[model samples]
Target chain A: MDMTFEIIGWLAGICTAVSFVPQSLKTFRTKNVAGLSALTYTVYNLGVLGWVVYGAYLKSYQMVVFNAVCFAFSFSVLAMILRYRRRSRL
Target chain B: MDMTFEIIGWLAGICTAVSFVPQSLKTFRTKNVAGLSALTYTVYNLGVLGWVVYGAYLKSYQMVVFNAVCFAFSFSVLAMILRYRRRSRL
Candidate 1:
């Protein structure tokens, strides 16, 4: 693979990995999650987990790092949604 | 790459790509997007577009196909958020 292509892949990975930050921050700030879906987050986390496994299988450092970071952020958001939803129900 | 690894990659890609369907369906059914973030979607679209470019550079058909599907679904959700926000503001 060309070095340039590798750089592009890294760039893409970074972008995708960090894409959840703004939303997570918003959710943290607002503590509002009426628009968020638990089912979506659950499935998304599973997908990210699959990517993590695939990354390990392929020995792709970029894939592993990117998806790992994404999984953490996504998991946090999912946790927040669960917390908020439970609180709201009470 | 091992064929098994390729299969895992495709599985991961499919999971990630189709992950948005449930959320999009929920939004469509409920017509509720109070929790969706326009900024997040915008950045996400950019990220997915970056992935598309990176996929093209790598000649990875799976990457290209997966991100293309993701981009379409993310865009529709963004559009819905915009529309709903505008209507709600009035």
Candidate 2:
């Protein structure tokens, strides 16, 4: 096993997992997805769903756990944005 | 081979790849990372780097191409954030 790849995996996993912070912060702070694109969120949500399955198939806990958390967070933000958008439109 | 997985893979692949749009948009539109976290971006950049390698190892073109594009986009945002952060602080 290449130790470098292992390190890479951990690094990538953590980074990808944590990368959602800005959006979350923005979502929380602004309480708006005014500038955010709905299409992007929809696509991302689908992607996270994919990661979940991909990780499960690979039997890699790292992929599964990381993507799961990321998915939850993304979903939360997406929901918030959608709610805010709907309320604003109404 | 499960066709379901292939569909899921494409969905996840596209979702994950396109998911960066909001961030990219925010980065470009806002012209600031004021609300964004540097640590998160740092970790994410590293994660994209790992994905590049992981994709290569798995010989999955979806992984490689999607990650490569995402990496470039993420790196661009990261760089912009760093530059903006520095300018504002100075």
TM-score: which candidate is best?
A: 1
Chain B TM, every candidate: 0.89, 0.88
Q: For residues A1-90, could you state the per-residue lDDT of candidate 2 as single tens digits?
A: 577776776777777887777677777887756655566667787888788997788788888999998887778777887888998998
Q: What's the lDDT of the predicted structure labeled candidate 1?
A: 0.84
Question: Against the true structure, candidate 2 has what lDDT?
Answer: 0.77
Fnat across every predicted model, in order: 0.59, 0.63
Residue range A10-85, candidate 1, lDDT tens digits: 7778877987888888889998888887887887888888889888987887888999999988888899999999
Please give, for residues B1-90, the per-residue lDDT of candidate 1 as tens digits. 588776777777887787777778878787788888788788778888888988898788888999999888878888888998898999
Each prediction's Cα lDDT score?
0.84, 0.77
How many residue pairs clash per model? 0, 2
DockQ of 2: 0.50
Best by lDDT: 1
